[model samples]
Target: MAFQSIKHFALELDGPDDIVYSSGEMVTGVVILELTREIKVRSLRVLGRGVAIAHWLENRSVGVNTVYNDYTSKTIYFRKRQHLIRDNGDLTVIPAGRHEYPFSFQLPEETLVTSFEGKHGSIRYWVKVKLHRPWATVKKIKKEFTVIEPIDINTPSLLAPQAGTKDKMARIWYRNCGQVSITAKIDRKGYTPGEVIPVFAEFDNSTSRSVVPKAYITQTQTFIARGTMKQKRAVVATLCGDIVGPRRRETWHGRAIKIPPVGPSILQCRIIKVEYMLRVCVDVPGTSKLSLELPLVMGTIPLHPFGSRTSSVSSQYSVNMEWLRMAIPEQPEPPPDYSSVVTEEEAAQNSTAVQPEEDLSGVLQPSLLAYIQEFRSRPPPVYSEVDPNPQPITMRRRCMTC
Candidate 1:
């Protein structure tokens, strides 16, 4: 095929700087093509490219010491070209100085993360222009730019478990051909008070190959109970047994326990129940590493009172429980009394009027006389011997004489 003569080609975009655009925004640009010789073209297309790259690095501090690191890279590309037309159409031949073509592409909305500031990472994108013609070779032009200010998104880490009642337990099962078979179970849903949830982790190496396995376990507990309420508690117990091809089972415990990572390994628990959540992670070390998490619900279920038993078995292993505590919600204190306050009418009716005795100064105060006159006019005072302090006989006689 004959090749087309060298032509002028350039690419430009609309949003090139630190422009903040959402995922659903339209990214637009134009590809200008100037041809020196008249050429018949076929079809043209615009393309948007997105890619993610990841790498890891390792450094050893000293002899027999090792460390590991990781890095990531991402990129995007955009491309578009003009279309040729045949038949009766309003297509004009290029006399070729500078040509302006408009192109547009839609951005994805889901790419925006709402969790972190500037949560959106940079996308190194490029625009490439390609010209295709029969009897002529294709020409190309390229330009590069970046998209910034994406929506902040917070995605929970795979190792981090959510805290709540609805969370579920996670179990992973995998097999290594002719080597070992592994089954791991984690209580991702969370634990109840006095409930001994089991994390059953098993590895079987029945293949002809001799295999050694290493495991790491981490448990976190948070006490959600407070005030006079007892704190939530958790305990993780691990047991390893060897089964050699129909041989009798040999169990290891306490000082007799010996695994690749030699030590007195005991499960760890915290006194304070986490108000938010707590995560327990287990990492198995091997060429193919697998990690899982168990979420412990803090104070959701009541801890059974002391010396209580349940008809439940260990969730991880089939171990019997001697005691179980029930979880209960804390009771609120009673409010204060507001029943003693009386209204104005009730106070007036319940009060008694005082009567004046024998004008001791030989003169009666008009205010006292007026009060006595008002009381007598309304009703006769009901005298009761129950009241030890009674009005004097002189007052009674004065009232009678009046």
Candidate 2:
């Protein structure tokens, strides 16, 4: 075996485990070095870098031959370098046993994208330490950390309710069958993981074929390279209602779709973007689906306190950023495309609960009276629903560890 003097070379971050760094946050860490003998060092340096990059290859058949083209683009958000040991012409000898070099960096005050690993692109932040010796090879160690740029959901714009309506006409053999229309609304557009999103929607089917009403949370990832762009979408969570007979109507009164653990929306990046959409759809038997999409922004912080919650229910839930560290145990493949087909395994995991109807006619229920007693601490959510003719909807949630 070859001789080596260094026993350990690692970078350790400070703060609580699974702590997510944010903009304008202080990042403190230590570079540890353990050596068995005296080591001569020219200079030791630390570098912090964050960037978004996209690269993909496409094939084109030129007559009988296939040609491959490469597309690449990169945007640097921040770069910082500091010398732990300054060099001055001559080599600096470092007598080694175990050395710990402490370092601190202040993230930029400007907006920074959250840490993400996508299909064709990614936004990443990391700290790298390099050791330079007179005659020995340069030793490099890298450690990646999660950065979740704070987006408060309590802002006026994100707090205002969002609603939309869409209509589609069905056709068969160049003949008009009928029309299907759907209206969907949400209390707000911003939310954090573990919070519940009350989806209020109405579906009307005038068509001859039966239609099923469904709602889902979808994630869209966009990557741009050399002016060319690639996009991938996946359904992260979903809930379904009973079928609406032809020429019938179905309504969703504050249906709950809990936002699963996921990375925040990444919009400040140049080459990559992560966006979410809540879609309420009607599946037509033989034609395209009629869908209504509402934009959604996931955040790192919850709304106001747990008392005055007319829009969000779980105001007690704080930031859950574990997906950042647990998401990518290794390189991640792109999420699957959005599909309505529920396999047996997925159906087995469906949550079907009968929610109690709210006393919207100014009647205070016993549950609210009990909930108001303790304002200091918030209780866990009662997986509930509403309707006089209560139709329990089946919900399927797909969480992105990334």
Top model by lDDT, which number? 2
Flag regions of model 2 displaced more than 4 Å.
1-3, 306-402
Worst 10 residues of 1 by lDDT: 385-394
Q: Taking the tens digit of each residue's C-alpha lDDT, what string does model 1 give over 43-161?
A: 34455554322222335577677765333333222233334233233333455356667777675554421111011122234456665555456566665443322111111232122
Off by over 4 Å in 1: 1-7, 15-20, 55-95, 112-123, 149-402
Supply every candidate's count of residue pairs whose N, Cα or C atoms clash at under 3 angstroms.
24, 2
Error of 1 at 85 (Å): 7.1
lDDT of 1 at 153: 12
Every candidate's lDDT: 0.30, 0.65
lDDT of 1: 0.30
TM value for model 1: 0.28
Error of 1 at 362 (Å): 99
TM-score for every candidate vs. truth?
0.28, 0.75
